[model samples]
Structure formats: structure tokens, C-alpha cells
Target: MISLNMLSLSLILFSISAAVFLLRRNMFIMLMALELGLNSAGMAAAHFALTNSQTEPVIWALLFFAIAAAEAAIGLALLIMISRKFSTLNSDEIKELKG
Candidate 1:
């Protein structure tokens, strides 16, 4: 059963994630927001699946969760490499890629 409170909480999380991803300068926090958005989306999908009695959305949500985990791992690795080289996690300050 999908409660109204769960829906509201998911909506709030999605909105906060969007705000953090768009308005924040720190790469680490932006990555965190990205994960938050992924999880909220997964929650919404699961809720929808439960309300509709469908298995597809639940599977899709699981896929999203897997992708979120991969994204977090890769993002953290990149963040680590970048921070070691630049000494900061600010997206604006970390520009200029070197090949």
C-alpha cells in the first residue's frame, strides 16, 4: 500500500535532489544528490508498482538501484582522483580537463 506520506516524502526528496544538483558547486554533494534522485525515483517506481500490482516497475526500480550504485562508485573514484590533483571538489573550480 502506497501511503500519501511516502509519496510526499519521495516528492520532497526528488525536489531537494534537483535543487542540490543544479545549485550546488561541490562535486561531492552533487554526486550525493544524484544518488538521492535515483533512490527517490526508485521509491516512486516501487510505490507505483505496489499500487498497480505490476512487476515491471519493481524490476525497473531494481535496475535504477543498480545503476545508482554504479554511479556512486564511479563518481567517488573520479572525485578522489580529481581531489588528489586539484585539492578541491568545487565543480566550477575543477574545470579544464587534461588529456
Candidate 2:
């Protein structure tokens, strides 16, 4: 049985992750926050599924994990390129693509 506390915690984690993504100027921290957001979302889905006896949310969480893995790979590659070009991992210093 999924409790209200689990749901509330998941929401709080997701919100904090989003805030971190938005507020952090460091590219690494932002990437970590994005992962955290994905994880919290998966947790929420799983918790809801447990309450309702549904398998769809479990499947969704698996899909999310796969997508998150792909995203992490791509994001890291981009970060590497950015760092190589700018010599810094800070987003503010790596804005060469800005118009």
C-alpha cells in the first residue's frame, strides 16, 4: 500500500530537483539534478502502481530509466565538448552557443 507520505516525499524530491536544475550555474550539478528529477518521477509512478495494483507504472519506470541512461550519455558528451571548448564546466562561462 502506497502511503501519502511516500507521495509527498516524491513530490518534494521532484520539486527540489527541478529547483536545483534551474538555480545551479554548474553544468555538473544541473545534470545531477535532472537525474534526480527523473528518479523521483519514477518513484512516484511506482508508488502509485503499488497502490492500484497496476504494472504500467513499473514499465514506465523501466522506460524512464532507459531514457535517462541515454540522456546522461548525451548530456555528458555535450558537457565534455563544452568544457573542452571553454576550459570550464560552469554554464555561465560556457555560453558560446548563445545568440
Instruction: Find the candidate with the highest TM-score and give its number.
Output: 2
Question: Can you write out model 1's per-residue Cα lDDT over 20-86, one digit (the tens) per residue?
Answer: 9999999999999999999999888878887788999899999998999899999999999999999
Task: Compose the digit string of candidate 2's lDDT tens values, residues 1-99.
Answer: 345677888899999999999999999899999999999999898888888889999999999899899999999999899888788888777655756
In order, the Cα lDDT scores of the candidates are: 0.90, 0.89
**Model 2 spans > 4 angstroms off:** none
Among the numbered candidates, top lDDT falls to 1
